[model samples]
Target: MSGGRFRPLAGVLAATAVALTGTRVSAIALPWYVLGTTGSAAWTGVVAFAEMVPYVLVKALTGPLVDRVGPRRISLAADVVSAVAAGAVVLLDALGALPLGALIALVVVIGAGRGPGDLAKEIMIPEAAGRAGMPLERATGLMGVTERLAQTVGPAAGGAVVGLFGALPSLGLSAVFFALGSMVVGLALPRGMGHSAPAPADKLGSGSGSGSAPEFGSGSGSESESGERVTPAPRRGAGSEEGYWRRFGEGMAFLRGEPLLLTVIAMVCVTNLLDAAFGQVLGPVWAKESGHGPVLLGLCGSVMGLTAVGGSLVAAAVAHRLPRRPVLFAAFLIAGPPRFLFLAFDLPVVAIVAVFAVGGFCGGFLNPILGAVSFERVPRHLLGRVGGLQTSLSHVGVPLGGLLAGAAVTVAGLAPVLLACGAAYVLALGLTGLRPEWREMDRLRARPATARPTADGPVSDGSSGAEGRVGVRE
Candidate 1:
């Protein structure tokens, strides 16, 4: 925990925040730009769909590459590309040469870069935490806090910039943020920080009896921050050309074995789909139709972002103490339906923002729980590939959501679409609450980190009896 050890984390955290802020700014700017210029909800949706397709596709397929090339390199490169893409949009607009086709293409480039860039940063958190002598939960919480803060700052800033100057200026600022993010990564983080390989499987169990912290920069750890030892991971051979698919396959196989993880992944995927529809397309359409302008759009998001930041802070402080299953289910129940229903109604703008804020508050607890479980389950060495796949699955429905919602809004009115999606959100949450596998979330809270499993069940060594928590990538 020396100042020297803390430098990398500071850099990573700053880079993550800046990069996230840029993306969020662009998120608001791009959709608003399309809506303003074209005045067509469908085109806005098409642009959104175009961006997300590449985001999800490249993120899903490139996990092995991220693992092999290392997150630092990927993160730096991705940010640079993102900056260029944003600049392209702004430059085109300035030249009065912006077209739907050209805009979509540039946004696609932005998404492609963002996908790996985000995964790389997420992959670095545990590594940064371990090296800095911080607990994993606290580290992840800090990360959640950073994201929530960025969420608050990015949209509010994007909205203000768009409201004052225009969408073009906001896009231009996005490029500045991306470039700054790249600079932070390049200058601040040390080489080979996130690139170490895991100790062989046979070596993992040998350290079970010891209480020492895992060695920093080791790529994998035999111990978690909770003082429980990790289960002996079966090590794979070194990375090579032929090993890429095999590594990718390994990540898939790991996820398949963890049904609870898979369940969480599926649930988040559906919710992310719904959220994309609501945020990127539906929200903008509502703002336009209500004559609220881009300022209201930003204000509503800012309120939600602020409340979500509070929720995330609370979750970070006390997530380990909360009951995993019921708390998680309740958080989702509160978070999901309210915004849609509020938008569906003819309530005043104040009422609408309040509901969105409440939903954002409840939504904040989710990531801490999900992140804890993911880090505890997956060995660090495989985080890039495994995390990438998880991220990809979680976002798979995003493009479809935008596309379908756009078409639906074009065909049917916005009110009906809002009502239907709201009802669907309620139904999905209710169904998930009833699933038997959900009980596993609670069970995981009682298991130790070091507890390994055979094909049958967990290996019951006395060392794994310590407190447990769980996380997921979404």
Candidate 2:
């Protein structure tokens, strides 16, 4: 493959980085701003709930639309909306016309736009990887690295901006980042790179055994390893005769049958909730109560983010060779619980930073494994609906996490709430591991390379063989 083929992947990564960086910045800025202005942890949680609820709902409902309308268009539109909303917040605040209710409304708009925008970028990963001939694991790992880098940079910048220029400037910077992300997706990607994928007819129906669609790893028609001739489903979209409900139902049915996917989603729901609680409520509250403020909070996050980058790079390099189930289990063990415990104890700032660094490093291995597995199992065409549902479901608890944490802190005090959440994290992890479906993570690693009879002769889908592995080195 020529160097030019990698352009789509590069564009996606760039867009993801800047957009996520802006989000991370807002993560710090919004909570700090709310906490400082209102002096109420419950209000901070309410703001988080306002933003995330819309994000999850809109993302869940828009999967089929993404399939029909094309990811590129949806992504561009979402970012544009995000930019406008973020800018509006600062502008309204500057004019002394901003109210809490109005702030929540704007946050709702930003969240709604982020849902589809994030989904659009994600669904394009497989196509971009295929075009670049990069393996799924490596591609997702690089994506993780980009996210981690953004997390590092965004929080650090957010803290400094909030410290020196105040929260409004940080919000304005987020608007700039959103604009830049939009520009990258609109201009950097080639035509048709992020378009709706060709589907298999049986993808949405029960006719296909295992409900599996053909892998679009090559972004073109290819035979599967089972000697089955995999052909593209008829094109259906906004102009097509197919109705939206039918398309949506297909995705739902497909997701329902996947035991592994369901298991992953359930586990993620718990974790995302805990993470949101920590990031939005517990962390900031700790910062304020300790009198350390946003700078210390940002410093801890940046430390974690920096180490996570290193871990992601390592995962990208060697994840394909490692066992998925064990790595995932270990990652959670190292990454979860400890932060809460450290905070509950009110440890020295250096101790908190050190724990966060270690935890972030382990956490970095998660997305690459999960992303590769999800993409590899689902057919290319259903990426939008299926992936969207998966992500949306995983985030279901996010909105409530902050709300509950704030209420719990108010009633039980921060230390006890932190300890309770930490214990719950451990219990959730343990229970999730009891499921037998996790073995499939490693079992399916070589399934992509099975022999298939093509018109010429026997062939492979090029997933695991030398030809398929010839792309960029991790």
Candidate 3:
């Protein structure tokens, strides 16, 4: 069952890399197009708001869909939509027919696709790793690297491409990336590879044999058979379409039962909310107004990203040995508040860059650990549905963060806004730490029950069947 075809996996990876380029271009291109065409800074904000609203709204609804239908399908469909949207922009602009309303509509559509797109990519890594017989920890390490690089390079590349050749050309390039990404995902992935978490016989029939790992079950359907070895999945029996209310309830029920996972999700939501407020809106404004000018702003942004790269490198080296709880704790501690302080102080390039870099590094180190922790702690069956819900919740904060930051900056001084956000981050940390489940952060990493085998096949010396082990540490 573990015999995986590496060629297919390699193809997915290649597709992943190419498809990811559009993410970079979209980040810079969307804002440019909005601001340029609308000629209103306020409309720029509106466009961002419009885009993120659907991303959150749809993702919250689609978590179960991704779990049921399979990520491969979602990714394939999204890539097509993304390419069409970008192409449409190019087509409309070339003909001088692109209107602000149409542009906003497309941006929102792309944003919605992005929610599922990001989740599919993130979830696929572990599925492939499982197929290739790769360790989950190693897979997560690569996640950290990809995230750091994308966040770091994407913006600069987007800016440079847009600045030199204009938004349409850059957007055209984005269309190309999406087209390639779509083609590869649609054409290259080995059949049956995308079934990360098999649903019960009801919804998914049977997966192609990529069942959940150890602890989690997605609850789409669960019929346990004694002595069934938890390995790759089998094909599901059928697909039953249920009402949206029923599916949504099922997804929520799964999340509610997973307290440990729920905590992590909530924590992420809090952190993202605060960070988004500062990073996307306030920080940019501060940089523009701080006498740093565009060139210096770009330099500072680049430097900040590089810091994240360094942080990710350090995390990769030590993550397998680190306690999961502390990783979560320390990441938040380091990531929060510095942005507001940097703004309030209006420090020199050296000081601001140093602070931003530290913030970036902390952020880079944070997510993979959380992701590894989240995925590791749950039952395998729930990865997609749970991932969907979790991702939706985490992203919900983005728009809120932006809104909060905007209101704070408007009502209070920038310093107060940062402080308020910082305080919120701290509160989140404290609350998450209070939960008993967190104390077992490294419980899963403890020696497996068979570390000291008995007369039986394998049993824990000190723990019960499936008793928790040391976690976070591999």
Q: lDDT: which candidate is best?
A: 2
From the highest lDDT down, the ranking of the candidates is 2, 1, 3
lDDT comparing candidate 3 with the true structure: 0.56
Model 3 per-residue lDDT tens digits across residues 1-474: 444445555556666666665765665566556545654444555666666778767766765676567778888888788788878888988999877888878877877876666566556765666566655556556544554554555556666776677668777887888788778877777666565334222211111121122332433323236312232233353223555565557556755755666666566566666655654455555644565533344445555566766776787677767766777577657666566655676577787767767766775566545554454433454455555666666556666655556556666756666666667767877977888877545664441211110000000000000000111100
lDDT digits (tens) for residues 141-192 of candidate 1: 6766777777778888998999999889998999999999999999988887
lDDT, residue 362, model 3 = 72
lDDT of 3 at 426: 78
Give the candidates in order of TM-score, highest first: 1, 2, 3
Better of 1 and 2 by lDDT: 2
Against the unseen true structure, what C-alpha lDDT does each candidate score?
A: 0.71, 0.72, 0.56
Question: How much is the lDDT of residue 225 in candidate 3?
Answer: 61
Q: Which has the better TM-score: candidate 1, or candidate 3?
A: 1
Stretch of 10 with least lDDT, candidate 1: 459-468
**Candidate 2: deviation at residue 175, Å?**
1.1
Off by over 4 Å in 1: 199-230, 233-237, 240-242, 451-474
Candidate achieving higher lDDT, 2 or 3: 2
Q: How many backbone clashes can be found in candidate 2?
A: 1
Superposed on all Cα atoms, the candidates' RMSDs to the truth, in angstroms, are: 7.1, 7.5, 8.8
> Estimated TM-score per prediction?
0.88, 0.86, 0.77
